[model samples]
Target: MGDIFAEGVGIAGRSRTALAAFALGMSLVSSAMSFAVDDTPGIGAEMAVSSVAGYFLFWQVMATEGLLDGSRSRGAGFMAYAAVSLITSVAGLLGLVLLILPGLILMARWSLAGALVVARGSAVFAALGESWRLTRGFTWPIVGFFAAVCMAFAVLLLPLGIYAAVSDETANIGAAHYIVEFISNVASYGLSALISCGIVAIFALLVDRDERMASVFA
Candidate 1:
């Protein structure tokens, strides 16, 4: 926590500007992809665009994790993570849809998959398997940690939420309102980055703990 707060989480301080730009670009590209496929038929452009967008999101997550772990590799790393995103996402989503508890458990168990894949060049399935193994008996703890993080984030975002709430369904909104909304958006982005950093920190901490436990067993 101290290191992440002081030095710059998974995204190293020096390159955050580049990261923000990259995130912006990926979002725009994803939006364009959706627009391009808006009217496509069954199993068409929408699905393809969704897959691409999912890839970029996964790529960013793993890339940040890798950066925090001091991995110098790029491009190919992102592509690899993107490919693995499909499998992890389906597994997680299925768990969530069929039974919420199962979904939450699966998500918690698989949360470190991105970090594992990024840090080790492991296959997607291998990474997911490792996460499941490492997280054993820790699922509830993981969920509680994220819930606390979200609560803290919500506190920071309260003002924005209030403003948005008050302005809801109003026509002829003004420049001041737009400025408020912009501020809100920037705050949201900062919080999001912090959460990502938190995830990296959690992965590192837990992995270290796992190692120590294994040593005791040995």
Candidate 2:
């Protein structure tokens, strides 16, 4: 987990320029969405949107950075990644609603599907299956990683949350609000990118380990 975290941070640092552009674009899009609604859709919805966009942009980054096997099949791989991601997200949400543990397990298990889709040109279900198989022994560790991530996210956003609450109570709608919102959105998107990097790192490590084991057995 520590290695994955370190690798993820390294990836983000090395590709900061591209990642910053992606994060800025996402922040603008999220701001537009909020403006279109005439209200912020609460932090939950914002986080969901950020997560989706982050993975999509991260996949593109991986392709352009030569980290993926199917870089030439970007369009097809993107479509498959989107489809599988939607299903996985919905199913994971359902699992969460049923019981928190199952949802976490499902999410952790299928987390690598997007990486597989873009990196290995896997079909939707195939990617999900491969992710499930790869994550078999790492479920608890992944869950722990996710928990740590969530805590860090909450810490990062806590100031924004407090400010939002205070503003709501005081009806303080002004330039400051917009400024804070923009900053918060950027931070959210940046965190999402980091999470995507970590997942990619995990996917690479798991795939490599699996191959080494297969060779040993063969």
Best by TM-score: 2
Stretches > 4 Å off in candidate 1: 1-72, 83-103, 158-162, 165-168, 208-218
Q: Model 1, 44-82: lDDT tens per residue?
A: 653555445434443455464543345535444555566
TM-score of 1: 0.59
lDDT of each: 0.59, 0.77
Worst 10 residues of 1 by lDDT: 1-10
Which lDDT tens digits does candidate 2 get at residues 1-218?
77777767777777777779777988887777777765546445766666566656777667544567634464557678778878978988898799878887888999999888777788899889989999998898888777787788899889997896788689997888878888987887787777777787787678756767999999
Candidate 2 achieves a global lDDT of: 0.77
Per-candidate TM-score against the hidden true structure: 0.59, 0.82
